[model samples]
Target: MIAISDPIRIEPWNFAPERSNFPTRNLPNRRAEIAREKQLTTLIRENNRSRRTCASKIAEMAKKAGIEVKPLEIEFIAARAGIAIS
Candidate 1:
């Protein structure tokens, strides 16, 4: 027969990743790019327009609204949003 003095042991976790050996990521911020993609998606769905037309329209509107947006940025947004570039 075996006799155990203490059967259970409990330890508290601090949950500090910085203190522990956890790897941290240093990723770039892409909020603006993501926001632009969402806007492009909405515009495409609303008008059922092609990439070129949408890009031109967005550029014109941005120009009128005093926002500096380039045509290439629009193309990238369309591409990121999975819209067909025509």
Candidate 2:
């Protein structure tokens, strides 16, 4: 084994958690940008139910109103509306 003049090139790779190669399953939700979130928050507050129930109800409402919303976004909206959705 003798390699005095090898034409091999190698580069060091830095691992960054924020800039990973894998793509996220869900896209970023417009939590504050959506105007209807306020209304949805109100609805969530009006209903006296658990987190899962509220999420399902809000999803149904959003579906009926032809609005695209996710369960996580609902939690954010509820929090922004000053409602404890824990």
Full-model lDDT for every candidate: 0.60, 0.64
Q: Which one is best on lDDT? A: 2
lDDT of 2 by residue, 1-86 (tens): 97979888875353544434433422233433454766776667766365546665676677777777787887777777767654
TM-score of 2: 0.43
Candidate 1 per-residue lDDT, tens place, 1-86, comes to: 77687687764564554333333331223455456667656755444464446566776666676766776776676677677655
Clashing pairs in 2: none
Off by over 4 Å in 1: 1-33, 47-54
- What are the models' TM-scores? 0.43, 0.43
lDDT score, candidate 2, position 36: 71
Show where candidate 2 strays beyond 4 Å. 1-34, 46-52
